[model samples]
Target: MKIAILGTGAGGRCHAAKLLELGHEVIVGTRDPDATLARTAPDHMGTPPYRDWLAAHPGATVCTFADAAAAADLVINGISGDHALNALTAIKDQLAGKTLIDYAVPYVYQHDSAHKWPTPWGFMPLLDPVDSDSLAEQIQRALPETRVVKSFVTQEQETVVDPKSIGGGDHTMFVSGDDEAAKGRAAQLLREYGWTDIVDLGPLVTARGLEMYAHFHSAVGLALGRRFGVKIV
Candidate 1:
């Protein structure tokens, strides 16, 4: 399968490497291929440069966002929350009639708050479409022809791609979308990633809870000083 991961961040890298190991052709999308490869410093989260990661994984390819989307049979929206909308909307034509598994949270990284929920990284970022709306719904609306399924938002990035590392893979993952087939495809990918328990929370609106769970996930991670999994039992 040709899969396009529309970001070069740590989360995107995790998916890219896993997909490659699964024998899928991985095409990673970035704002600028040259700029991404030229970076020597780590990202804000201290993730190593793209070039360094690319060196470790030789099978994966890097290209512009549109090129990657155009070449892939399936697309994964790993773009950051703040830039996902604009970046995706720009290549709407390429993504039409494709299954896009979006795991982005609509987080506004910069905000003014009198009181904030502090974490190991800093105050937790604010969710833009909190309560009433979700990033998945927004992307679905933006690309009406694309089948969008929301998943992978509820777990830590590394644990998401490698569920067995935590709790012996005895946890649950959730998928939400109006399109049944798309949700099925997303669940199949989760299974390939070693996830045994996947719940299909019907309709894209349920993404509100999946995304909003980020705050609680962060709080728990900080409290535990490590990554953990959630089992729906």
Candidate 2:
């Protein structure tokens, strides 16, 4: 499949590299591919610069967000949760009839005095109302033509790439999408990537739980001093 992964950050790089390994024709989408190529700094997760990562994966290519979407059979949205909507909206015209796998958690930025706990990612509130309408649901509504599947969002960095790294891949992943076929496709990719346990939460609205899960993930990370995925025993 010709896949386009949006974003050049840790999430994007990890997902793109794995897809390339699986023999998919992967093209990464960025707001400015040219500028990304010029970046010398490492990603937030301290991974090597994206240019270096790209160099390692010669099979992958980069292009503007719109162009990448236009050419892909499937699009895996690896853009940051905060900016995903804007990025997809810019490329909306090209997404019709495409199975878009969205792996972004919508984390709203609080600009008011209610500044919350400080984390590695920044100062986001400890609790927010992602349930009113999850980010994935909003995206589906905004792009009525696209089949958006929400999966592989509960993890990040290396763990996002290989869930098996933790608990021997025994942990579970939740997938939610209005389109059943789209969820199946995303689940296939997850299994290809060595995910042994996958949970179908049903309907795109179930994304509310997935998006809210970021809080639980972060809390456990902070409490235990490490990242842990949710598992059904």
lDDT of each: 0.93, 0.84
RMSD to the hidden true structure, all candidates: 0.8, 2.0
Question: Which pairs clash (backbone N, Cα, C closer than 3 Å) in model 2?
Answer: none
- lDDT of candidate 2 at residue 187, scale 0 to 100: 91
Clashing pairs in 1: none
lDDT, residue 174, candidate 2: 83
Question: Which candidate achieves the best TM-score against the true structure?
Answer: 1
Candidate 2 lDDT trough over 10 residues, lowest sum = 122-131
Which ten residues in a row are the worst by lDDT in model 1? 114-123
Give the CA lDDT, 0 to 100, for residue 69 in model 2: 94
Candidate 1 local lDDT, 1-233, one digit each (tens): 99999999999999999999999999999999999999999999898999999999999999999999999999999999999989999999999999999999899889888888776578789998989899899999999999999999998778899999998999999999999999989999999999999999999999999999998898888889889999887
Give the clash count for model 1: 0
Q: Best-fitting candidate, measured by lDDT? A: 1
Error of 2 at 137 (Å): 0.9
